[model samples]
Structures are given as structure tokens and as C-alpha cells.
Target: MATAAPTPNRTPPALRRKRRKELATAVGFLSPWLIGFCVFFAYPLISTVYFSLTHYDGFNPPSYVGFKNYDYVVTKFPFFWQAVRNTAWLVAVMVTLRTVFGIGIGLLITKIKTGAGFFRTAFYLPYLAPPVAATIAFAFLLNPGTGPVNHLLGQLGLPQPGWFNDPNWSKPSLVLLGLWGIGDLMVIFMAALLDVPTEQYEAASLDGASPFQKFRFVTLPNIRPIIMFAVITGIIQTLQYYTQAIIAGQVASGVVGNSGQQFEPGFPDGSTWTVPQLVYNIGFQRFDYGSACVVSILLFVVAMACTALLMRRRAGLMGED
Candidate 1:
């Protein structure tokens, strides 16, 4: 027997109107963000990709020279590799040290029963200092001949090596600066540590687990997600590191912008030149917009790749947990 035709599955008119109104409200709320994304992010990204394949200074019309900019950056550009190396070194060393130091400080603060808020405020104050001002202050403090730090070393008869002025020590000095301002990371870790259930710790103690054992099996497992988030963000931040390095280099080299002469970044034999600094120097300083765009694209690729890898690893870790 033939089945009766199914009733039309149309929504009630009132229901449909309500749904449409809700959708309109949602779209209205989202419009500002959508406009901002298009104007600030999407437009700039598309422009960068287009410019990477062309030769253009700000005043000149773009001439398409497809991939030559990339080739020159890879092969002929003198400081490209140096910038890459410096950026990579910062990402590896600075990020690792910041993570460790942040956790250590966080743990220490958590153990403090009295005036923990004061200590947190003191630590976080350094992060509030403007980056340019901070870098300049640090450079002056470490100045080889006249700075108080070197003077103290002299009085103590310790061998005083130039910090930002020395190629061997510049990156290390930047690491120290990074650690000094790691209070943001510390705060995050502290929150995570505090969030860990005390019941787990009591349970572990009942099992006669050592402090380290409890931390490893209980605390770490509970806070693994926060740790991963910190690490990922730290890596991304380090990859785009610019201001401090440039300012430190400039201060150390005593290269204030002089009559039509641009101050070269990554002073002290190009030791502290980072990829982002390179992009700035190329695009604005040298007026090589195409090459700058190429470097930017490469940097974008590297950042995206690193983030993807870390996210995948985080997923695996969460699965294991």
C-alpha cells in the first residue's frame, strides 16, 4: 500500500520570524568584528602576499618579479640568515628560560603565606614598564665603562664583559631582560597551580608519595593544559620579538638617528638582529618593500608551522592524560 504523502515540514511563521530576528541580532553584534578582521587582518595579509612577489617602494608602482625577492632573501641578503638564527635562538633559549623561571616564581609565590600580594605586585611592576624605556634603562645599567653594574663588577674585581655591546653576550642579555619581565607568565602559572585540587595532594600524601612525585603525577597532570598554553604563547611572542632587541642594540651602539643617516639595527656585529627587526629595517630603513614582504611571509609561515606543531603535540598530550 502507498504511504500517505508526508506533511510539509515548514516551520511555523512566528517561529521562523523569531529565528530570523535572533540571527539578525547575532549578525549585528558580529558586524564590528567582521569589519575589523577584514580591514586590519585580511586586507593587510592579502597586501603582503601580493607585494612579496613584486618590487615596490612606497613611492613607486609595484613591478611583479615573482619569487626573486624570496630567492635574494634566502641567498644574497647578508643579514637574513643572521636574523633567522638570532630569532631562532631567542625562541629556543628565551622561551624555555621564561617558562622555567615563571613556574619557579609562581611556585614560590604560592608557598608564601604572608604578603603574597605584595610580592606579586612587585614582580608584575617590571612587566608594566614600557618596552622601549625598559630596554634603554637596561642598556644604560649594563654600559661597559660608566654604568653602575660594570662599576660594581670593577670594584669586586670580577671580569666585566660588555653586555649588549658584545656579540657573545647580547642574546644572553636579552634573555635576562625577558626573564625580568616574566611576571605575566608567572601570574598565569600561579592561577593554574592554585586551581589544582588540594584533594589530589592529600590523596598522594596518604599514598606516601614524595613532594616531587605528587607534583609530577598530580599537579603537573592537572596543570598540563595551562603549561601548554603558556609555552605556545611564549613561542609565538618570542618569534615576533623586536622592540627590546632594537632598542638595546641602538643604545649599546650609541646610534641615535643622525642627519639622514638611519641607525642600523642589530648593532654589535649583527648579533641581536631578529626577523621582525629585519622586516622593519628592510621595509622602512632600506625602502625595499618587496624583500620586506618576502621576509614577513617567511616569518608568518614559520610562526604558523610552530603553532600547528605545538597544538598537535598538546592534543596528543591531552589524549594521553
Candidate 2:
């Protein structure tokens, strides 16, 4: 038999020491992020968990209450349930509208052979606008009395809605405002659409597939993962809907004061009130940190449940693939 190959020499101690030094250097570089995580994320999360179980206002010592806050939120807080219903409605409607419009716009853009860059920029520029600025601008444009939108609608003899002022029209106005920012999702969908294999398209064409058939059978399936990503993220975002609603509530409620001023949020009889708004009202306005923490934990649980459900669906899809 051939002589056994010489065993590899053990790593020299110097090399091992050098590796250890490099590892230390790498860790040193990561120290800031690691420290930030522990301080900001870990500490706050742990504290929230602890405080959610106790009654703690900002100034007073935390009183160990043991689920009373949660019970109160579940049973006594009337607005809490309304916030839940409103948030659920927002999540359902926003996610569906964003997905449909985002994909539709993306598909349309991809079919353009000329000035595609211009069209892409035009479509995506809205997403680049600051959220607050965009919401303020939309508030102006949708103003019930003096807005240009209603003026034009009047010229066309259409019913001019009381957008932010009227309770019935408030949520729909927010939905319309959300659609203006669908550009982000559109860009993602465009990327996914462009990534569909041309070979599949060719095969479908050879099989005499119509455009709709090709899209339904090939394009949609290929881009399903991207759509799912957009939907899940959209769901999470809708659950946390706050800034736009608050700004809309403030501006439309005819309270043109400093944004910092303590105005009742979710105006029009609390029609625009959401869970995050409720949490803010509890924590900062009422100084009920314990109840706020409880609400925060509940939101966290809902988000985690949604994420888990999506992950399970993703696992099933992957298995099928």
C-alpha cells in the first residue's frame, strides 16, 4: 500500500495567535452595534415586559399589579376595542390596495420600451418625499372647504367629500393618502417582475398562452415571494399606523397649532384613532406607562403572530417549490 499521506502539520502557535488577534479586531469593530443593541433594544424590551405587569407612571415607583393592567385593557378600555377594529380594517384594506396597485403599476412600467427611466422616476418620486411632508401636502390637497381636489370635483358636478373632517370619509382619505406612497412597493414589484425567467415566457408563448394566462401562470408565481414580502411588511406597517392619522386628524380637525401641542388625536369622535394612538395617549398624555406597556406588548404579540403565520406559509411554499 502507498505510504500514508503525511498528516498536515498543526497550525503554528503564531498563526493561531494571529487568528485570535484578528477575531479580537473584528469584535472590536462590532462593539458599537453590540452595545447599542443591548442598551437600546434589549434593555427597553426587557423593561417593557417588566413594566407591563406593574402599574408604573413615570414619576411613581412601579406597583406590582400582576396582570391588572392587561385585564383593564381587555375589559374596561372601550377605545381599546375600537382601536383594534380600526387597526384591523386599516391593515386589511391597506395591504390589499398596496399589493394590487403596486403590482399593476409595476407591470405597466415594465411594458414600456421608451422613456422607462422617466416613468420609473415619476412613479417612485412620491416614496422619496418625507412622510410628514407628504401627509401635510395631501391634507392641503384634500382639504374639505378650499382644496383643489374638491374644486375640480365640483367643476365636474361630483360629490365633494369632507375628507378628513367627516368621520365617514376620514379613513378612506387616509387610504388614498397611503396609495400615493405605493411607489416603494411598485419598485420592489418591478424588480421581481423583471426577474421572471424569459425562458418561461417563451415556453408559454409556444403553448399559445394569452397575455393574462402567461401572467397568471408564470409571472405571478415567479414573483409570489416578493409579493408576500410586500404584503407582510405592509401588514406590520398598517398595524402601526400613527403619523399620517395623527397629522390628518390635527390638520383636518381645524387645529392648526404646533405639532407638539397636546391636541386630542384621532379627531372626528375618535374615528381616526388607532392602537398606536391609544398607546401614546396612555403613556404620554395620561402618564399611564403600565397600561401603555401592556398595549405595546399586545401589539408586539399581534405582529409576531402575523410574522409566524407568514413564515409558515413561506415554508409550505418553499416545500412545494
Q: What is the lDDT of residue 33 in candidate 1?
A: 100
> Would you list the C-alpha lDDT of every candidate in the order shown?
0.92, 0.92
Cα RMSD, each candidate: 2.5, 5.0
lDDT of 2 by residue, 162-231 (tens): 9988889889899998998888998999999999999999999999999999999999999999988998
* Ten-residue stretch with the least lDDT total in model 1: 253-262
Off by over 4 Å in 2: 1-33, 258-261
**Candidate 2 Cα RMSD after full superposition onto the native fold (Å):** 5.0
Off by over 4 Å in 1: 1-23, 257-260
TM-scores of all predicted structures: 0.92, 0.89
> CA shift at 17, candidate 1, in angstroms?
7.2
> Candidate 1, overall lDDT?
0.92
Cα displacement (Å) at residue 53, model 2: 1.5
